[model samples]
Structures are given as C-alpha cells and as structure tokens.
Target: MRRKQAGIALITAVITAALVAALAAWIAWRQQLWFFQLENQLDQGQARAIAYSGVQLARFTLRDDARNNQVDHLGEPWNVPIPAIPVEQGKVGGRLLEQQGRFNLNNLISNGVASDNDIAACRRLFELAGVPPQRVDALVDWLDADGETRPGGAEDAAYLALPQPYRAANQPLTDLASLVRVQGFDAETIARLTPFVSVLPPQTPINVNFAPPEVIAAIVPELALAEAQAVVSRRAGRHFASVGEFIAALPERVRGQLRPEALTVQSRYFISEVDAQFGRVTVRYAALLERNGPDFPRLLWMRRR
Candidate 1:
C-alpha cells in the first residue's frame, strides 16, 4: 500500500514538471517574438526619417559648398555663375548637376559649314581623346544638313549594312549615353569622356567662362596651357557680362567662330544620382533633371525609382 502511494506521488511530480517546462517555453517564445517586432518597427521608422532628412542635408551642404568655391554642376570649378539644389531618396542624397554650364555636342556640325569654335573643340577633343578619326569624322557628317557623308562619318552605304532601315542621319545626340553608339567608343571609353561633354539642344555653345580644362584643350588644342590659364584668370571678377562681352573674351583667332545668337543661359537637362544604406538595406537611384534656374531649383524630369 505504501509502495502504491509512492508510485502515485512520483507520477504526479512528473506531470507537474512537464507542465512547468511547457509554460516557461511558451513565455520565452512570446518574448522573443515581441523583441523582434519592436526592433523591426524601430528600424523602419528610422529609415523613413533618414531618407527625408537626407534631402535637407543635401541642400544645406550644396549651397555651402558652392558658396565656398565656384565649381558648376560638373566637379570642376569656375569663376562663372552656378546654382545649387537639394536632392534625396530612400536614405541617399545628392545635387542636381546643371548641364547648361558646358558646351553642347549638338553644335559640332551645324549647317553645311562647321563655323563654330565649339565645333572645332569637339572635333579636337575627340581626336586627342583617341576617338578614331573615322568616328569623329562620322559625327561631323551626322551633324551636317546634307545627306553627303564627311570623310569619316557614316553614310547611306554604312547604314544599309546595319539592321535598321534609315535615310540621312542628322539627329542631335540625345544624351551623353548616345555617344556610346559612335564608332570606336565602348562602355569604358564613354565612362572616361562623358564628364567633359554635354548634350543640350541644338546650337548650344560651350560656356567659355565655365568650360573645364579638358574642354579648353578640346576647343582649341592649339590653346597652350598658358592661354587656357589666361582664360581662367580673365573670367574672375567678370562673367561674359553680356553675349557681346562673352564674344570679346575669346582670342582673335577663335573669335570669328563665336555665334552670338546661339548662346543662352537656359538649360534643358541635368543629371542627379543617389546611393544610400541603412542598417541591412541599401538603395541607389539615377535621374535626369530639366529646369532652368536663376533662383529656385526644381525637378523637371526623373527616371524610374
């Protein structure tokens, strides 16, 4: 009878221990779940706030940087006018680069005659950069009004060999990316040269006051380093005060090529990019912007998010 009683007590004790272990495990599981939920909520909240704050910070940083120095939308500095704007997305931030500050590649072959100094520079630049003479010549032919191909430009004969059916090819370069299609240029080459070039509406001249050193070399390869340096020295404390002022700034040899009517301050496109990471997450964005600005900066266009 005593043995039977001890056996019942052992059974009861075993059952009680099982129930206690199960209960403790349930509580620990719930705690772990709640801890994860809290962490996730905090991370999302912080990410959203960081993305928006990035915009404000970009504006502040850009203005201060521009004021401190004179570089335009490109990385190079100048003595001419430049503006700043705020940009950000998903924890990343950057500034919109104003494309108007540089010479337009579209001007390379305007009309039957390449009458612009910008045209000369573009040719000279492409040549010095080791762009095949044939490709540079092809660009000139593509720029001309007539169907006749220049010495190196693509013609009807060349186009017929390709997959597309086309006639005379005289379209302006739509973007810096378009240059990659030019013969002798590959992804690597485009990456190297895109910074020194811009694609604006037809007939846009190179802004002499803000043209970079490479651009200066491209414009007039004959331009000795001293002459380009002199151009920079003269630009300080003055802006092409007017179109006429800009014309007067050029050297006598290159002076005749400046077409006053073709120059303007307005720009039709810009480029901006953003990259960000918050904790385990990362995001990147690239876009094109188109807005003219004397004061306020705003978005005119954007690419996919």
Candidate 2:
C-alpha cells in the first residue's frame, strides 16, 4: 500500500513540473512580443518627429529664398534636394518643388464660366500628352456650377447611374487625386498628366522659369515641342529673370502668339516632401506652402504617412 501511494505521488509531481515549464515558456514569449511591439511604436514616433523637423527646415529655406530672391527657378538653392543625413537612429531627406511649374487645372474656369484661353491651353496640353482632348470638356462640366453636362461631360445624374452611385463635385479640385472622381479620368490618365499639370488656386499663372518643356509648348501657341526643349535647355545656363526674357527667348514665329500675362518668372506656390526612417519604421511628410512678397511661406496644408 505504501509503494502504490509513492508511485501515485511521483506521477502527480511529474505532471505538475511539466505544467510549470510550459507556463514559463508562454510568459517568456508574451514578454518578448510585448517588447517588440513597444519598440516599433517608439520607432514610429521618432520617425514622425524627424519628418516634421524636415518640414520646418524646408519652411525656413523657403522664407530665406523669399527674402533674398526675386524669382524662383531650378538654379536657385531652394530648388536643390537635401541629401539624406544621419539622425539619432536613422536618416532624413527632403526636397522642394515649384508648383507653378505645371499648368494649373483650376485656371480652366473663372467666375462660374469657362475661360476660352485656359481651355485652349489645356487642350493643347492634352494633345501634347496624347490624351483625348475631349476629356477637357468633362473636366469643365465637373468644375462649372450648373448641372448641364457638356457633350463629353458627366454631371450628378451620370454619376448616380453608376453601380456604386455618387455625385459629381461641381467645384474646383482641392488636389490632383480628386481627378479620379471626374469623368474620363482614370488612374493611368491622371498619372500620365501629373508631370505637366497641377491643381492650384484659381488665376495661378505658369512660372516659366521652372515649367517643363511640355508646359512651355502648351502655353506658347505655335511653338513646337523641339523648340520648347531648346528653351528649357537654355535655362540650364541662365534662368529667365522676367516674363519678357522668357518670351523674347522663344522662336520668333511663336513669340507673337505668346500671352505674357499667362506666365510668370516667380512662383507663389511650392510643395515640400520629407522622408525619415528609424529602425523598421518610415514616415513621409508633405506640405503645400504659399509665399507672397517678402513674407515667410504659409502652410496651406500638410500630410504625414
């Protein structure tokens, strides 16, 4: 009887030891997972902070440029991209882009009406990009306040007819991504046009000093793409100091057709992008800034991801 009792006791002790070992392993695993999660959160916080600091750096540079320079161009110091610099745990980098360098889509409509000159310019731009110029008509209807749709346009009714119904936004676009909501604009089309076009406040003129060859050609009627390329190539040696200088440099044939009022040598709007990475976490910050006269650039909007 004593032997039987001893054997039963040993079996119970062995099972208890096995349970204790399994519990210890589970606790260790849980603690390790918790540490990993906490580290990732810390890395994310650090990366975001570094990204914001980079934005302030851009703002300071733009403010200095406003005070010192009369014109914004590719040759200016503010146009240069900041090389990646090592931070406490990782690196950060940034760049400034002149928004006025691209054709402004908001300029297509003014005072609740479509501007013929702007429409013509956009048509030329679309043709140059090999996109259907008819897309412009749809864009116009999207911007115009009235419900009447143009031949190639879609209004509220058309959108409501979709399988997933929505309404047309009869207003100026706040960002380039809004183009996907407009008729005839797909991801591919918007991507193709992004290099040459922008969505900025109304009446914003194209900054000739930084505009691409396609934009230069579009704005200057009768100017061929090759001639526009030559114009851009010349800017490498010396940027245009004034609209007059840009116009005078154009081919004599197209000079007569150029609208000096539709172009500028100065930029009022700019985009700043900064990236920061820490550990396995990365963050990107983007901001739109507006500078007027000798004042510091104003932050219009910002996003971090």
Candidate 3:
C-alpha cells in the first residue's frame, strides 16, 4: 500500500513540474512579443518626428530663399533636392517643388464664372497629352456651380444614369486624385496629365521659370513643342527674370499669343516631400506651403503616406 501511494505522489509531482515548465515557456514568449511590439512603436514615433523636422527645415530654406531673392526658379536653392543624410540610427531626405510650375486646374473657373483663356490653355494641354481636348469642357462643368452643363460635359443627370450613380462635384478640386471622378477623365488620362497639371487655389498663375515645357507650350499658343523644349533647356543656366523677359525670348510671331496675365516668374505655393527612416520604420511626409510676400512660409496642409 505504501509503494502504491509513493508511485501516485511521484506521478503528481512530475505532472505539476511539466505544467510549470510549459507556463514559464509561454510567459517568456509573451514577454518577447510585447518587447518587439514596443520597439516597433518607438521606432515609428522616432521616424515620424524626424520627418516633421525635415519639413521644418524645408520651410526654413524657403524663408531664407524669400529673404535673399525675389524670383523663384529651378536654379534657386529652394529647388535643390536634399540628399539623404545619416541620423543617429537612420537617414532622412527631402525636396521642395514649386506648385506654380504646373497648369492650375482651378484656373478653369474664377469668380463663379468660366474663364475663356484658362479653358483654352487647358484644352491645349489635353491635346498635347493626346487626350481629347473636349475633356476640358467636362472639367469646367464639374467645377462650375451651375447645373447647366457645357457642350460635351456631364452633369448630375449624366452621372446619375451610371451604374454607380453619383452627382457631379460642382466645386473646385481640392485634390488632383479627384480628377478620376470627372466625366471623360479615366485613369489613363489622369496618369498622362498628372505631371503637367495641378490643383491650386483659384486663379493661381503658372510660374514660367519653373513650368514644364508642355505647360509652357500650352500657355503660349502657336509655340511649337521643339521651341518650348528650347525655352526650358535655356533655363538650365539662366532663368527668366520677368514675364517680359520670357516673352522677349519667344519668336516675335508667337510672342503675341503669350499672355502675361496668366504667367509669373515667382511662385507662392510649394510642396515639401520628406522621407525618414529610423531603425525598421519609415515615414513619408508631404506638405503644401504658402509663402506670402516676404513672410515665412505657412503650412497649408500636411499628410503622411
């Protein structure tokens, strides 16, 4: 009887020991997982902080540029790309681009009315991109407040008839991605036009010093693509000091087609793109900055992507 009791006690003790060992192993695993998660969170926070600092640096650069020069151009310091620099355990880099370099979509309408000159410029851009120029009429209709659709344009009725019925925005585009929603603008057209077009505040003029060759050609009627390319290439060493200078460089015949009202040598809006990596985390930051006169640039909007 004593032997049987001794055997039972031994079995219980072994089972208890096994249970304890399993519990210890599980606790250790949980602790390791928790530590890993905590480390990732810390790294992510550091990366985000670093990105924010990069944007502040870009703002400072713009402010310094404003103090030193009245003209904004590709040759200026503000347009220089920030090379990747090592941080404590990671790296950061950024670049600033003037938004005025592209054709402003909001320029299509002003003061609750359609602007003829801006429409014509946009049409030219569309034709240059090989997309139907009539697409601009659809864009104008989308931006205009009235329900009456322009020729070859879409309105509430047209959209409502679709399988996934939705109404026209009837307002200025705040985000260029919204272009895909407008009638006659598919993904392919948006992709082609993205590089030359931008959504900025109403009536913002294109800065000729930084405008792409295609945009320059669009804004200047009768200017050949090769001529536009020549104009842009010449800016590599010297930038246009004023609208008058840009017009003077053009051929005398096409010079008359250029309108000074829709062009500028300086810019008011800029984009700051910053990338930061810390440990295993990476952060992408983008912001729209507005510089008013000589004052420091103000952050219009910011996003992390």
Candidate 4:
C-alpha cells in the first residue's frame, strides 16, 4: 500500500509539470504576438507623422522664399531637393516643384466661355507630347457649360450611349486624373501629358521663369525645341526677371508670336512631394501649396500613397 501511494504521487507530479510548461509556452506566444502588433502600429503612426512634418517643412520653405524673393525661378532655394534626413528610427525626404511651370488644363475655359487661343495652346502641347490632338475638342466640350457636343466631342448623350457609361462632369476638373473620363483620353495619354500639364484654377497663367523647355515650346509654337532648351539653359544661369525680359531674350521672329500676358515671373501654386520611411514601411505624400503673398503658404490639398 505504501509503494502504490508513492507511484500514484509521482504520476500526478509529472502531469502537473507538463500542464505548467504548456501554459507558460502559450503565454509567451501571446505576449510576443501582442508586442509585434504594437510595434507595427507604432511604425505606421510614426511614418504618417514624419510625412506630415515633411509637408510642413515645405510650407515653411515656400513662405521664406516668398518673403525674400520677388521672382520664383528654377534656381531658387525652394527648388532644391531635400536629401533624406534621419529622424528617431526613420528618415524623410522631399522636393518642391512650381506648379505654374506646367500649363494649366483649366485655362482652356474662362467665365463659361471656351477660349480659342487656350484650346490652340493645349492642342500644340498635345502635338508636342506626341499625343493625338483629336481629344482637344472632347476636353473643351467636357468643361464648357453647354450640353451641346462639339465636333468629335462627347456629351452626356454620347457617354450614356456606351455599354458602361456615365455623364460628363461638365465643369472644371478637380483633378488631373479626371481627364480619363473625357472622350479620346486614356491612361496612356494621361501618363504622357501628366509631366507638362496641371489642373489648376481656371485662367491661371503659366510662369515663364520656371516652365520647362517642352512647356515653353508649347506656349510659343514658333520656338523650336532646341531653342526652348537653349532658353531654359540660359535662364538657369540668369533667371528671367520679367515678361519683357523673356520676350527680349527670344529670337526676333519668335518674339512677335509670344503672348506677354500668358507669361509670369511669379507663381502661386506649388507641389511638395515627400517620402517617409519607418522600419519596413514607406509612405508617400504629395502636398499642394498655394502662396498668395508674404503670408504662410496655404495647404490646398494633400494626397498620400
């Protein structure tokens, strides 16, 4: 009877030890999972904060530039790219681009009236970019207030007739990607046009001081690509101070064809592209900024990807 009791006690002890070991292993696994989740959440929040900080930095840079300089040019300090700067366990980088350097697509319409000159300029831009100019009419009709379809353009009636159809916006484009809704524009054409065109407030003029060679060529049809490139190169060393100075620098033949009012030395719109990386995660932000005067730059919009 003593031996039997001893054996039974030994068996009970072994079973209890096994149960304790299993329970401890389970608790450790749960703790590790919770820690991992907490770390991931912290990383995401940190990345987002870093991106917003980058945008604010850009805003300050633009405000400072506006206060100090009268002319916005490619050579300005705001145009300089920001190298990646390490923060507490992460890094952030960004660059500012003058939005007025590209032709504003909304310029095609003014006060409910379609401007022939603006349309022609858009056509020239499309031609220069090797995109088919056939879509120009569609864009005009899409933006114009009237429902009447222009030749080769689509209206509500035309779009509704398609297999998977929707109505035309018939208003100013809020975003550049909205161009895909207009007839004759596809993702490929938009990709080609994206670098040189912007969707800004209607009637915004293109800033000649920072305009790229392609945009300059589009604006002044008489100027050859090489000539526009030369102008850009010259301006890099000595920025154009005024529309008159820009016109004076142009060749005599091209001078007469250029429109003075369509050019500007200053810009109100800019884009700040920022990238923030934390651990294995990366966040991209595009902040649109508008500076009207010496005041701090206003955040127009922010897009994250």
Instruction: Estimate, for each residue in 233-266, the C-alpha lDDT of model 2 and write its tens digit.
Output: 9998998999988988988878888777888888
Candidate 1 lDDT over residue span 53-100, tens digit each: 443443444444445544342233322222322323234544555565
Models 1 onward score TM values of 0.55, 0.91, 0.89, 0.85
RMSD of each: 8.9, 2.7, 3.0, 4.1
The digit string of per-residue lDDT tens for model 3 on 1-305 reads: 99999999999999999999999999999999999999999999999999989989988888888888889887776677888899999999999978899999999999879999999989989888888999998888899986475333446777888899887777889867789889888889999998899888899989988888899999998898889999888888899999998998887899877668888988989889999999999999888898887788899888875
Give candidate 2's TM-score. Answer: 0.91
Write the number of the candidate with greater TM-score, choosing between 1 and 2: 2
lDDT score, candidate 3, position 132:
94
Off by over 4 Å in 1: 1-90, 109-118, 130-133, 141-170, 217-225, 236-257, 262-268, 277-279, 293-301
Model 3 vs. true fold: TM? 0.89
The C-alpha local distance difference test score for the whole of candidate 4 amounts to 0.87
RMSD of 4: 4.1
Clashing pairs in 2: none
**Best-to-worst ranking by lDDT:** 3, 2, 4, 1
Q: What residue pairs clash in candidate 4, if any at all?
A: none
Q: What Cα-based lDDT does every candidate model obtain?
A: 0.56, 0.88, 0.88, 0.87
Q: Between which residue pairs do clashes occur in model 1?
A: 121-219, 138-153
